[model samples]
Structure formats: C-alpha cells, structure tokens
Target: MEKTRAILVDITKCIGCQSCEQACKQVHGFPMETEARLSPTALTVIEEHGDKFVRRMCMHCEDPACASACLVGALRKTATGPVTYDGAKCIGCRYCVVACPFSVPRYEWSKLAPLVKKCDMCAARQSAGQLPACVEACPTGASIVGWRDEILEEAERRILGDAKYVKHIYGSQEAGGTSVFFLSDVAFEKLGFAAAPQQPMPVLTANALGDVPTVVMVGGAVLSGIYWITQRRVAVADEERRER
Candidate 1:
C-alpha cells in the first residue's frame, strides 16, 4: 500500500515570500494576481500574522467532511492522502463548501459553469515521486513534505528541540487529523485558525446520511395518505352534486 503523504509547515521558518502561492498559481495555469487569497485561482495564500507568516491551504483531513458532504462523490480522499475533486462529477450544489471545517474550498463564481477548487497536494507530482510544487518552491524550508507518520514525528521533534515553539501541533488532531501539520511560535487562534472539533466530521455526516432512507420512506407514506384522502373528498363532492 502507498504510504500516506503529508506536509509539515514550520511557521517560524517562513519569510512571507509568497513563493508557494506563486508556484501553485503557475502550476495550475492560473493568471497571476498582485494579492493572493484562498480563491479559485489561488489554491493557497500566505497571511501576514504580525511578524509571523501563516500559510493557509486545504487540510486534507483523514476523513474529510467535504468528501462526505459531496452527494455525488465529486470530492474524495485519495489513498495517497490528498482530497481530490472531480469537476465532471460535481453538481455545483456547493455542499462541500459548507461542510469543510477549514473553509478551504473556492468556487469559480465568474465562470459560466463553475467548479469547486482547492489544493490537491500536487497528486500528479507525488505520483511521479516529486514533492508538491509549493513545497519545492519554498525558498526557506518552511514547507516540508513526507510520509504522514514521519512528518508528525518531525513536528514533535522540532517543538521538543526548540524553546521558541508554542508546543501545540495544529492539525495533528484537529478535524480528526489532517495531512498537513503546522508548527507555530504563536497561538494558532491568533493566526486566524478556526477552532475545529476533534472528532472527524465524517462520522457525524454519515450518521445523518444514514437517516435519509428512513425519512424518505416515512415522508412518502404520509404524502400518499394525504393524496388518498384528498381524492376521496373530491369523489364525495362529485357524487353529492349528481344526486342533487
């Protein structure tokens, strides 16, 4: 089996160069923009958090809520540890957008027919045994990619070895663990990180979805009963008119 890939982001090492952002745009054939945000064209962004630079992108959860929210299976967590989207399969309902805890997915609002967009962790590059474009483009070694287990261990080592680290590994357990991990000197909440539930969202989504069949069956029965009663009333009214 292919080992799950992951990325470790050391916020302390980042210089806010925006190299990763530029690289992502270039690789995806998106037009260059002066300001980068988590938009349809820009899959990632580097936010200036006072003296620190925070990189924001898809978390790629182990059990992604976006994938679960996709009724048509347009979004899926691949075996290689990236959450990928199939534009053809997408119905443009935007359920994934609402379901994502990280609020990472973007839509091409300007396009006639738009599709949801987010980082796929450069799955094509990884399949060819190359690092992700952003990780490779990083001038500083802020963005590092490796196997998930190894990366987690490396994040631990950095925190343990350095007194500057904040001691919390963001994404390690948030939203049921993500493929991307972060080591920050400042509190993640101060960096605009959302407070996410520890439990995997897929569990909740699945439980809700499991109730769909029952709900549909009960609804159908009630609607049928109402229709039958209405038809009987109409028939009785017609018979009374004929007798009169």
Candidate 2:
C-alpha cells in the first residue's frame, strides 16, 4: 500500500549527452567524470549502443537479492523504493556483490576497509522531495522518476502509442519487478541487458543459505571434539613423562 518510487527510462529519448552520468558523479562527490563501468565512484553509467545510448544503474528490485544476501543487514529495500546501504552495518562479506542479478553492487577493492557500492536512487534527495540527480540533470526527458505503478502506466502508454517502441517493458517482470523500468526502441538484449528470471532472487538465495547455519553448527561441534581429544592426549603424555 505504501507508494514505492520508480524511474522510467526511455532509451529512445537519450541523446548520448552523458549529462545524467555527470550529475550522478557530482551528487556523490566523485571525480566528476563518467566511467566505463559502475564503480564505487560511479553509481550510474551511460553506455553507447551504436546511435543509441543506454543508462545502467541499480534496478532497485521489489525484493532485492543484495539485501537478502547481506549477513549483517547492510542492505535494505526501502518501502518508498531505493535499495539503500549502510556501511556501518556491513561486515565486508561481499555476498551482496555475488547475489545481485544485474551485477549492480560493486566492492571497494582498493581500500583496506572496503565498502559495497551501488545506486540507491538518491534516497536522500527523494526523502527531501527532490528528483534523483540523474533524472534532474537529463537535458532530454529520457529519464523520469515517480510512483512505480504510475511509471508502469506511462511506460505502457508510450509503448502502445508509438509503433517504434519495443513491446516489452524491460523491468516489469524481471526478477519479480524492479523499481526502475526501461522503454527502448531497440531490443533490450541488443542493448546489453541481461534477461533476468521472473522469480525473485531472494527466494533462491534464502533457500541456498538456509542450510549454511546448520552445516556450520555441525562442523563446529566436530572441530571442538577433535580439539578436546588432542589437548587431552597432550596432557596424558606430559603426566607419563613426569612419572618416569
């Protein structure tokens, strides 16, 4: 019932200006330069696909795999949308990086105390009732953010109204729906978007990790028993040597 935010991205409207990329970097106080990939410094990236340009960022899934994979609850899927991260709660497990379907989360590999980095759809800015930096900085109306349902309606409207638009809404059912949606004149696969499963990843992740705790408990008990036996043997040998 709580209205979650979504960003509707029209790839056809993008002009390869890189304005959105610049805005993301500036807002995050990075180098102010666009990178080829999503790094700790760059939350969003603009990739040139021949004459078309596509933007890539966190999909902000309805049920995010990154949040589920986090051992310390470092990542969270907020009700208003945005997969937010808390560095303090993070335990440097890097499980989130592995669990992400879109390959969105990045680890700060160079730093001694590294952070898992990715976009949160500008959670702070949205909380202040402002548009995301990338959306606000778009010279063209390529990207717009609003309620998830409303954005889906708009995406449908455009696809239905225009013959040039693709029939598929990229993020609508991908990984059980994401806050970020895409409208492209070209096929998403051609634009380098991976076809994600319709099932939410958290389900699969939870099932996989569910057995881990049991395994660890059993393994620890076995190791403890071995240690106790080894220590007892050493103590018995010492007594024998003293008696002799």
Off by over 4 Å in 2: 207-244
Give me candidate 1's TM-score against the actual structure.
0.86
Query: lDDT tens digits, residues 131-211, model 2?
Result: 999999998899999999999999999999999998999989899999999999988999999888898989886777788
Model 1 clashes, total count: 0
The weakest ten consecutive residues by lDDT in model 2 span 201-210
Candidate 1 whole-model C-alpha lDDT, 0 to 1:
0.93
Please write out the lDDT profile of model 1 over residues 26-99, one tens digit for every residue.
99998888454699988999988799899999999999999988999999999989999999999999999999
What is the RMSD, in Å, between candidate 2 and the native fold over all Cα?
Answer: 5.8
RMSD of each: 4.1, 5.8
lDDT of 1 at 23: 93
Each model's backbone clash number? 0, 0
